[model samples]
Target: MTTQHLEHPTHTHTHGPDCGHQAVSHGDHVDYAHDGHLHREHSGHWDECESGAHTTHDGHTHVHGSDCGHEAVRHGDHVDYVHDGHRHAEHDGHYDDH
Candidate 1:
C-alpha cells in the first residue's frame, strides 16, 4: 500500500468586548492513493472564543450577538473520502489503457 499526505494551515481572528477578542488557528491533513482515488483522513482544532464575540476563520467571520444582545458562535471542520474508478480519466481523457 502506498501513502500520500498533505497539510493545510489556517488562521482565525475574533473581536468583542464582553466576550474578549482573540485569535484561533488549526491544521488539516489528507491521505489518498497515487491515482487520486482512495481513502482519506483529516483532523484539526479551533481556538476557543467567548460569547457575544465576533470570530473569523479562513476569512469568514461570525458575529455573535442578537439584534443588540449577546449571542454564541460555533464552527467546525469536515472531511470527505471518495473512491472513483473512471472519474479522472473521463475528465482528462488521459486513459491510454482501456
Candidate 2:
C-alpha cells in the first residue's frame, strides 16, 4: 500500500472531546472519523490517515455498504462491517480483517 499525503478538504472544525466524531488511538496520536474518512492533526493542517498494510479477504462474495445488513462499526480510520463473528474493513477494492 502507498502512503497518501493529501490534506482533508472542507475540514474546518477542531476534533476532540465532544467534537461528534469517534476517536481512535493510533500509535502516539489520535485519529477522528470524519465524513466517512479518517483525519489526523498534523503540523497546522488535517491529514487523511490510512493503513498501508492489509490482509486481503479472499473469495468473499457478499458486499458491504451503508445499507448492508451487517452492523457498521467505526474503526481507526474507516468503517468496518460486522459479519459472522468478525469485522470486515474495506480496503482498496476488497475487504480486510479488522
Candidate 3:
C-alpha cells in the first residue's frame, strides 16, 4: 500500500514495523517501522488464489458459508496464487504448477 524508495536503486525498502503489510525487497535492505513486524511475500514456493490452490491462509479457501465471491482476495504474505482453489500465483514471472 505504501512504497518508500531508498537512496540506492537496488536497495528496496521494507514496510518496516509500521504497516501490517508485506515488505517487498528488490536488492537493497532498507529499514522501516510498521507496528512491530515485517511482512514479505513468500519465496518461489509461494501460492495464492490465482494459482487455484486456495492456501489455508485463514483456514478457509472457497466460500466459507455463502458465495463470498473470493474472485480476488488476500492482503499479502501468500500472494502467490495457490491451485488448491485459488486462481494464480506468480513470482518474478514464475507461475504456480497449477
Candidate 4:
C-alpha cells in the first residue's frame, strides 16, 4: 500500500490591474484623517493567524477567509458567518434574537 499527502491548490484573484501587483503584508500601516492632521488607529497591524471576523475601530465588521477575500458587511444580529463558502450553523444561533 502506498500513502500520499495531497495539498489543496491555491487560487489567486486580482482586484486591480495585474501590472506588478503584489500581496499586502500585515506589517503595513496607513494613517487616517479625523479632523485635520493624520490620526493612527490600533497600530494598524494584522496577525498572520488571525482569520475569520474582524472589527475595525470605526465599528465596522470585516470577514476574511482563505477561499474568499475580505468582505465588509454590517455587524449585529443580521450578520452571517461564512466559512469556506459555506454558512455554518454556529452563526444561526444568533439569529434567534430576531
lDDT leader = 2
Best by TM-score: 2
What ranges in model 4 sit over 4 Å off? 1-8, 12-19, 28-51, 59-98
> Against the true structure, what is each candidate's TM-score?
0.18, 0.54, 0.19, 0.17
Clashing pairs in 4: none
lDDT against the true structure, each candidate:
0.23, 0.73, 0.31, 0.26
* Candidate 3 lDDT over residue span 68-98, tens digit each: 3323324244433223443333434343322
Q: After superposition, how far is residue 5 of candidate 4 from its true place, in Å?
A: 18
RMSD of each: 19.1, 5.9, 12.5, 16.4
lDDT of 2: 0.73
Q: Model 2: residues >4 Å from true position, as ranges?
A: 1-3, 53-78, 81-98
What lDDT tens digits, residue by residue, belong to model 2 across residues 15-91?
A: 99799887765555667777777788988889887655565778878999988888675765567776765557887
Residue 25 of model 1 has an lDDT of 22
What clash count goes with each model? Answer: 0, 0, 38, 0
